[model samples]
Target: MKTLTLAATAILLTAGFASAQTVRIGTEGAYPPYNMINDAGEVDGYERELGDELCKRAELDCTWVKNDWDSIIPNLVSGNYDAIMAGMAINEERQKVIQFTQNYVPPQASAYAAMSADADVEGGVVAAQTGTIQASHVAETGATLVEFATPDETLAAVRNGEADAVFADKEYLVPHVEESNGELVWIGEDIALDEGIGVGLRQSDTELKDKFDAAIASMKEDGSLNEMIGKWFGEGAPLFE
Candidate 1:
């Protein structure tokens, strides 16, 4: 009986070791609706659901890892994680550093929010999450750009009068505006940029990228992706299809 127990233990250990090699899905857990740390302190939200489905379809064992938004791309390149599904937009500049799966979410409108309806969106001081496309856009425009390490900080900056306006994804800003009662208001036209959101992978991880791409394509064809989008972002949300 002792010998039989030892053999079973060895097998179990081997299986556990293999399972530890799960593909790591990196994300910024701070971004709500897209991705966030739930009450249980695990990664949850739209990207969480979407990414899990893609991994299942691809037949890949996966796990989630949280990282700061500013270092997301760099950490992916450094092999800290196998892929990035943290609501990242696919753009030319990012493509130069790493490959991207086909966009799972379509191009989204970037918008500005301010404390007052008459705030100078184009010429006033604007706050944006550091290292994001919105920050880049603000830097190029006539507005003065103040960058924060996290999304919450950018919104806080506008609320505290450090910035006249805050620029970010329209969808992300919506909840804040709604919760603010009359304190916050959407201002300025939507700024459209990039192709869409996709999973970021290292340049050499074409196999992994292809798997995710195929999974995303499958979700689009079957309408499950669209359903998930609506479930998280409302029925009027933009979808890949």
Candidate 2:
């Protein structure tokens, strides 16, 4: 996308932060078009590209580290990684535990997918990834919320009749439904929650947070961030701009 100006690159180099030399970005490598393990067994996808660009613009040596979605935050708190670029949403509850860079991706619609078009979306068993906004929403609907550690498991639960439907980010579920042909179909209205998606850093790492925030801001200003979103999520995908 956008190339860093010489002046901006020089400023990042002179920022004098130790973490600037080797920042490890943690992510759930199971989410496609966001983050995924490629055939070569390495982290690959949208966040991979976006994270690399941010690191380059900030002049930081960086690498990717894969972690399960459920324990991603805990691992970051425990110093397993320096930052999270895992398509994590920014909300008040998460903000209580860690700091976030300004949102790089805008809030997206969450939806439900089921084996049949008439499947019950309310007051029925529902599957969702543990520790996610969709899980919380399903719980509040008086539905039996079956929590899974991963997104794929939620879809499996529905396919196997363990749950009537799966609630998740619409983008993440779209491909699964397409691949399933007519076996799976989207049901119910779209749910919108959280402000947007952002990079997460420990509360104590203000310098690292600032560095990434500036990098994200620069991408937004140069239209590179929107370009990346379109490339990965399709032309009609929502953008930060």
Candidate 3:
């Protein structure tokens, strides 16, 4: 009798564990359109909106956490966050350490400089976002790379003539350039570095990954994803037509 009761209790405990779901989403709140803080002191932007929708669709309790860009991956691996929603691109290197959900949006990259020739990068000094693909790309070119933690700092480096130009994603850079009072320019073409972006999870959490995949698919089907994109980039937003 005792053995049977113990087996039943174990089964119930396992069931309860299976049903438990709480996901922590991480983002670098410094990047606008993806994640950023407005004057209201609240985090607002594309990734935040999309993450809320994902949690609702998946029926999971969710919390948002702001993480520095360079530390996001490490925190996720340490189980500090269940997923990363910071417009993170899934690449071969990242896949080794984490699993990614389905792609959420079209891929886009951009390169730009100030309009004035004086702002032109000489001697190939370019500013790139630290820990991003753009930084890797510029480094490969053997350019004297000046790394910045935020988009604003990267643009500021170029605007102030501290660096030649900056390369990054179009989604965040376009609006910044226009709003910078002619301090920046959109270069001829965006550099294609990789495919679309997705949510990052620890390698052991395959069940959570499956949930995220289904939620993202539903979001795409119901046009919620499109709505969020338009909200951030506008109807005529480059890259999402």
Q: lDDT (CA) for every model shown?
A: 0.86, 0.88, 0.75
Q: Model 2 Cα displacement at 132 (Å)? A: 1.1
Candidate order (lDDT): 2, 1, 3
- TM-score (C-alpha, index-matched) for candidate 3: 0.85
Tens digits of lDDT, candidate 3, 1-241? 0112433433432332235367889988998788888798777888888888777766677898989998999999998988999978767778887889878877666565655645444357888889888887777876688899877798788777787788788777778777878666765566787667889999888778767777676656556677778878887653333
Residue 34: error of model 2 in Å? 0.6
- After best superposition, candidate 3 residue 204: deviation in angstroms? 1.1
lDDT of 1 at 36: 95
Candidate 1 has a TM-score of 0.90
Report the Cα RMSD per candidate.
9.7, 3.0, 8.4
- Cα-based lDDT at residue 208, candidate 1: 72
Summing lDDT over every window of 10 consecutive residues in candidate 1, give the lowest-scoring window: 1-10
What ranges in model 2 sit over 4 Å off? 1-20
TM-score of each: 0.90, 0.92, 0.85
